[model samples]
Target: MTTTQLAPISARAQFRPGLTPAGLVTVLLGAALPIIDFFIVNVALPTINADLHASTATLELVVAAYGIAYAVLLVVGGRLGDSFGRRRLFLTGLWLFTLTSLACGLAPTATTLVIARAAQGAASALLLPQVLSIIQATTSGEERSRALGLFGATGGLSTVVGQLAGGALVAADLFGTGWRPIFLVNVPIGLVVLVLARRLPESRAHNPLGVDRLGTVLLAVTLISLLLPLMEGRALGWPAWTIALLVVSPFAAAAFVHVERRMERQGGTPLLPPSVMRLPSVRSGLMVAVPFFAAFGSFMFVYAMTLQEGLHFGPLGAGGALTPMAVAYFTVSMLSSRLVARYGPKVVPVGGAIVVVGMVALLCTTLAAWPQVTILDLAPSMVAIGVGNGLAMTTLFRIVLSHVPTDLAGVGSGVMTTNQQTSLALGVAVLGSLYAGFSESLGTRDAFALVIGVVAVLAAIVTVTARRLPDPRV
Candidate 1:
């Protein structure tokens, strides 16, 4: 019997350097910190308000400032990484993030905390785009697939862990610190990541594009105009200024698009090239991302509220209730690459179907058990949701970035993350408002059920839309 020989690796495949295992770990760690910070404050807000004697408005600013700054600067951060060096910007951002985290921990007043939080968000913007850009630039084939999968898992798990850590830390109140430890904890971790990041391989575009000043301004205006109102409107009683900002957002977005298109036509580099957005994979992937992430965000918010208010779980208990989901998500995410390899992009729709089932289960459970529900009662549904989300999110990231060119990795990462952050904010704003309104009229149990039903419908949409995503390259 004759044995068939395997094909030889291509010159480009042989020459392309990949991240060392340690380097992959380091970048992933960097990725986790920003996402963790985003949700960490959710569980700590009440404690923060009590300790700082902060008003409701100030507390809202504390959250909004970070999110706004982070969202607004993400594209710029990606551009900087592509222009300068991914490794350099990663370190710069991490260093600044560390200092800001320290500042937040030591803040003497609510105003100071808000200022530090904004700085922290800006730092995150600088750091996050580099992770994806570096991964995209350095890795290939199975390595790239695995690295992206881990990145997705890190993001999902970090969201859950942030709240858990915050709840535990606040409940512990070590050194009589109250809510300060949540921010302070980042100091040691950031320092460690900074040290490990030294060994990371440096990567950047061969011919980097210069920053587009006008494009940046318009993009920021577009995001701020939209996000600020959505995030603050319900809380501020839908003020006239918020309404005006919302109205201005679409015009700002149109202007940004027109400017970008003109620059591209003139043979100049646009901040976000129209050519990239024209990719079928990128466009379709973003469609899935918006609703998937929106549902995930709203689910997290509503679940926490239900656990704490309706079922009367304390901070720790509420956080702990999510453990089954976290474990399931992490487990499935670790296996996502293998699954995708076997099943292709079909994995996404399968996952979305599972999510629909899980959400429906949750809705049913809430309706039936209501005031009598326990953490145990919620576990099965949580596990299903986690598994489904793990499968869908990991695959979605691969699908979106699969078509982005290596030279444009930074821009791609920035655009993807910006959409993600904006969607999350929108979810919290829209569904959160709906839940609050429904609760006033229908009570917490019925309101939660209704929201879960809505999420199920969104998941169904994901199941259908995911069919449009192109399969990853073999």
Candidate 2:
């Protein structure tokens, strides 16, 4: 069944969730896993390195491979879900993610772990899109808004929690599991979410189509070219070919766009429908999601690395540093609808500016204290920034999906997540590059402070643009 043929719900109707409480919670629980997997590895990376002796470049590939593959394959994954039935794909993906998580935990070599991580990412690609699709097809209006809000809240909080959990798991080393606990922990959660998802619901576009091969291949290549070089470049010492590969990326991207447009015009149900881009909410929200994702990815990567290598923090200290921010993000996200309704997404970017200012102040403090400041000293900034992040992240999701027509929900969700995942990889690359280049002379702590502070400034600029959103309410 192609998406065009589906009639699960009308585009203009109101959201209703009275009949789907168990289903909604089931789906939301399902929603948390992919996000949890996304950032959960950041805190565990040092342990992975110490245990496996992975190079800096290999460690990056471990993270980037998952993100790059997940982004590239997500639209196709959505299409598959639409064609086969969303519930089926959701269940299957959950199982795959669960099994792959085990594989990642058991991987004894860096190469094996990278491969398993890619598979895990692919599983996430299959699992994530169907979530918003289920919500969109099944719910309407206020119900939809609240569901999206919860999804955003959990998603945002998961990134923070991943760090802390990763820290705790590695520190505990349950059953002598060591860092493996980070991935192994997913087994129970995935199984629980999986069993629940099977009973949740199964809905599909009445006539969903099979995957788009041309678009999928082109996108995968485009992302690989763009990401691998960025992630691996600095560690490889910025070779000439890395710059060449980057220059080659735009051409590949343009080709992917052209091919997708052609496919859509020919009624092929291309992975990313051209029409999805025409939505004002999606385009504008994406404008914000891209930079926001990058800023986030940079934060986890650089902070984790700097704390361990630069500040002499063990996994415990580094992870502990993130706890306050995580709490703030969770607390504030639950309040987004009230806030966005009263003030709109405009408040988020304003809040982002405030956060950036707070971040800058914190960085300045680090510089002044230079080699003397402890992680404890940075807790206030972390909490303040978390508050700012909650406002910004939740508002961005609401603003972007608000205008997405109900019929195109799957593709819309796919595009949004793809933008997020890709931009995250890119953000890590760019910020990592800046940090690597700066660290040579500025010293680790100072260089990290400079790089993150600069990225926060860039995030403030992106927020300025995001505030131009046409509609902030759903």
Candidate 3:
């Protein structure tokens, strides 16, 4: 319970077999695929809809199914890695992801694509946590810090890259395959990474616990009950079933909490440990993560819609519009650690404030220019948002993991990522639906401006809460 008790764990970690540069790159590549896939489908959705003759609800499912499955299974995946081995789970996950990607590419129906996507999500859940767990287990001090920074940068940039890549692939229509290449492209990349991953060193918990069946089931039920209703309610015309599910969600979540606490009291491993959640750094960092990621997810989703549907941009143009933001994000993310080293955690609130400014700029521009606004006109605001995002996201990862004991690395990473992915899905469900509803009555331009304003408010909340994060020395 004291700082001295944790020192020996840190000292032992410093002597562990660490990742080679090649191995680090391999795992980071593994890290990128899932985050990229999440946003990649946004631009490709229209094309997928047309070719498969899919309905609105089905298209939403294409996105939601993967996200929901990934979010739900992440902690279990982490536990499996701890119980078996990180490298083993990583390789297994990569192979499964490749197969599922192929399944998605070759699917003849929308329903088939949704099922395949869910499988892909499961594979990702198995794959991603090991990246961080491996880093925590193998490296120490500056090396671990740098690895995590690069990991954060990969994650943030992948969101923009996903949409960009999706649009380019859809527009290329290679062999007249159209949007199918968006998923098909992953097959070769996954294979190459699988080969490279053979070199990664294996690590596992010293006393790995058995999987907690009741806890896993309850957590899944809680998330599904919450997310499914929000995602499908609008398209399904707010059915009685949706309302019932929504009503069930909170109770399910409470039950999950009670079970986890009880299991911990009984000296059994819960999917999420009460001890980890009780850490001030973990709890406060998560407080910042939820709203920040929710806003981020919704912003990306809604902005893509604005470009393609509202501005009438072609797929290529829509994706290309994000180029400025992507460039800024990459550049700033590389420099964010240096800034944190000097400025401490205050950098996060500053980043949040910058995001608000960018959102406000975007709102003003949208109001004034309407459908006439060009990508060139949007570049500055995009750059601002990108810079802000880069600064905040990298630091949030560090803060959450900063105090987590080495032995619980897998569980801690699992909890952090699950919170992140769940927030993303919820954002898309809530704000995306809000945008759609507003567009019907208020016109696309006004609806967009209103949503941007709401996003700005969320960013402001991030600014306020981030001020409370403990400023551990960089």
Candidate 4:
């Protein structure tokens, strides 16, 4: 594929030699770190609880804090990137994320670790939005498509690696670091990223508007209202406050929309521009993205629990079991751009079909094998899910950003990432809860089957939504 150099947006547009190989790898590494950290904590949580004497509630907070802060701040992070500069925000975010990670590793108490994780999540929000925005600002055409595909691949691989690596790291107990290596490992990688980020060409929105303080507050509150309750409610036994927050969430969301609309009418810059949503690509692509990621997020959560708890596998064994699927995912994701080129929007629906078939096959295999099922027995199902996920993720990412204007790249990316992150968290809350609830009554294997079945249904919805997407060439 040919590189598309950054087009001049104004007389002062920075000279960018498109995305250099080094520059692309640098930003993609930056993108992968936050995602890896998100799931890496799963295997380490037991060790953390034992080491820090953390209560169950505090342990849950350790995970939820990062996710809540990350989701709530993402849109604002995007706007900041647009208003200031993508490279500037990205570098700043990376630095903060590195430091916060260090704090997490060194914290002596659960509270301190929870606080540090929240800060790390905020830093991640800042770091992640700039990745796609930079790509959106710097490249176009086939170059843009390929970069997005790689971004999707990096995202997919990082989650799996986080699980496997987390287990391995904890087991190795490097330098007697115990669970600390997972966070500490980011220190060296972040420093390398810091050096490489200097080579990234800086870009910002032309005629960038002032930050929308009111809109930012409303949006953050709205997301927090919805996400906080969902993520923590089940763990906390559905407190009355959780119910209240859930009730208020819709109103908060409505208020956010009203505020943004008013800001747009007053000729102010909204966090998400009104016109951007008018693009058929944005609306339809997000419709599919939400369910696709929701299924994926919950599947990972539920599958990990099943492997460790129900199947009587240790952390290392559980993580290793997923390696085959990860391999399949990475391999297929590498080739997704070619598939998209051949099939256009049809690629998404085709991917959905594959995922359905995979889930059904896995369901059958799990039922037949039951207590004796091994990694090799589930290999075909894992490979099937990976291939389908690979195709859907890469192609859909390209479709969502394909039609966004360069000036709106930051906000557009923020919206897409926010949709994805929220759905992922929601998947854990809603679908994970369902699995937990079912496991109490039906036992582990049956509950897992039920969750997989639910995910397949969600994938079917993605197929239907994919039909509404505009042709990529449009």
Best prediction by TM-score: 3
The RMSD of every model to the true structure, in order and in angstroms, is: 6.1, 4.0, 4.0, 4.0
TM value for model 4: 0.86
Tens digit of per-residue lDDT, candidate 2, span 1-474: 001112234343243223278888887777777677776687778788889998666777788888887887777777777778778888988899999999999999999999999999888878877777777677767877888666666676676777687788888888877789889889998888877776765666656666888778888878887877877787777799888888888998899899989988887767777787878887777777777778877777888778777776777777888778878887887787788889876766776786787678678777777666677788888888788877887677667667777656556656776777788788777787677678787889778888777777777877688777766554
1 or 2: which has the higher lDDT?
Answer: 1
Give candidate 3's TM-score.
Answer: 0.90
lDDT of each: 0.80, 0.76, 0.81, 0.79
Off by over 4 Å in 2: 1-25, 135-153, 237-244
Q: Candidate 2 at 462: error in angstroms?
A: 1.9
lDDT by residue (tens digit), candidate 4, 246-361: 89888988888888888888888676666777788998898899899888877877776677667766667777777677777778878877887878889888888889888898
**Highest lDDT model number:** 3
Per-residue lDDT, model 4, residue 104, is 94
Model with the higher TM-score, candidate 2 or 3: 3
> Candidate 3 local accuracy as lDDT?
0.81
lDDT of 1: 0.80
User: Positional deviation of 201 in candidate 3, in angstroms?
Assistant: 3.9
TM-score for each candidate, following the candidate numbering: 0.85, 0.88, 0.90, 0.86
In candidate 3, which residue pairs get closer than 3 Å at backbone N, Cα or C atoms, i.e. clash? Answer: none
- Candidate 4, clashing residue pairs? none
Tell how far residue 383 is off in model 1, in angstroms: 0.6
By lDDT rank, best first, the candidates go: 3, 1, 4, 2
TM-score of 1: 0.85
